[model samples]
Target: MQCSQDIAAPSEVGAYLLEHLPQATLITLDTTGHCPHLSAPLETLAAMETFLAKE
Candidate 1:
């Protein structure tokens, strides 16, 4: 799942998933809104590309 910046808000447990799921890559996109897919599609795509390229 693509986690946007809002997930970084205080008390957001979803952000902790990255630490919990070390096996799965956690792609955190710095976005201004709640939906990265909508607010920053190009940036989000670039971030996804970078994430996918990681081992």
Candidate 2:
């Protein structure tokens, strides 16, 4: 998962991973910072739950 406004890693990194890694999932939280789990816990957890449910 990645934050939309994350500068440390950036959304492009997630995009690249998603493109290169098989079955990879990219969740972009609509917030700032690099740590989505800390900066946007609920959204992060929700995204994780949703993804895990699919798996």
Candidate 3:
């Protein structure tokens, strides 16, 4: 979910998350909003699959 986009400058939100939530693995998708699976299904699925495959 793109729940965090509500914060200022959604495009740069990843930076904030990375700095504050250091343990979290944040991935930013361009031109997407809350419920990216619906807004950007292909990109979202690809990113999820790639993350899952990582060792």
Candidate 4:
């Protein structure tokens, strides 16, 4: 899974990255940059635990 937080999406660099990817799992945190777990540690951990458990 790929996670991103408050990052620019319209840049050519961003578009280029998207072009090379296949099916993706995106976890977009409500909080901005500078560590999403810091803002929502338990929520992030729970999501991660659930995802990991499935694997």
Candidate 5:
């Protein structure tokens, strides 16, 4: 799965992942830069737990 910051991209990156990596998951958070784990730890952990629980 891919975790992307809402502010970091050409947008097509997420689209490409979804298209080319159909088995993968993509998560976008309303944050800046590339350190969502530090900036949004709770949200990031929650997302990770949710994704992992699915498996």
Candidate 6:
């Protein structure tokens, strides 16, 4: 998971991971900052739940 406007890691990092890792799941929260879980708790949790449900 990552914040769309994260400066520390950036959304490109997530995209790269998703492209490289076959099983990688990229969840981009439409928010700012590095910590998506803290900055976008509900969105993060929802994404997590949706991802976990697929598994």
lDDT of 2: 0.90
lDDT of 6 by residue, 1-55 (tens): 8888999997778889999999887877899998878888899999999998999
User: What residue pairs clash in candidate 4, if any at all?
Assistant: none
Question: Lowest-scoring 10 consecutive residues by lDDT in candidate 6?
Answer: 22-31
What shift in Å separates residue 47 of candidate 1 from its native position after superposition? 0.5
Top candidate when judged by lDDT against the true structure? 2
Model 3: what TM-score?
Answer: 0.61
TM-score per candidate, chains pooled: 0.60, 0.91, 0.61, 0.49, 0.72, 0.87
Ranking by lDDT: 2, 6, 5, 3, 1, 4
Q: Which stretches of candidate 1 lie over 4 Å from their true place?
A: 1-14
Cα error of candidate 2 at position 44, Å = 0.6
As a whole number from 0 to 100, the lDDT of residue 21 in candidate 3 is 83
**Candidate 6: where is the Cα deviation over 4 Å?**
none
lDDT tens readout by residue for model 5, 1-55: 2345445564578778778985977877665556678888888888889989999
lDDT of 3 at 24: 69
Clashing pairs in 5: none
Looking at candidate 4, the ten consecutive residues that score lowest on lDDT are 1-10
User: Which of candidates 2 and 3 reaches a greater lDDT?
Assistant: 2
lDDT of 2 by residue, 1-55 (tens): 8899999997779999999999888888899998888899999999999999997
Model 6 residue 9 lDDT score: 93
Candidate lDDT (C-alpha), each:
0.66, 0.90, 0.66, 0.55, 0.70, 0.87
Q: Rank the candidates by TM-score, best first.
A: 2, 6, 5, 3, 1, 4
What is the C-alpha lDDT profile of model 4 across 1-55, one tens digit per residue?
Answer: 2235535442344345666767434555455544557767876787788877877
> RMSD to the native, candidate 1?
3.3
Please name the candidate that would achieve the greatest TM-score relative to the true structure. Answer: 2
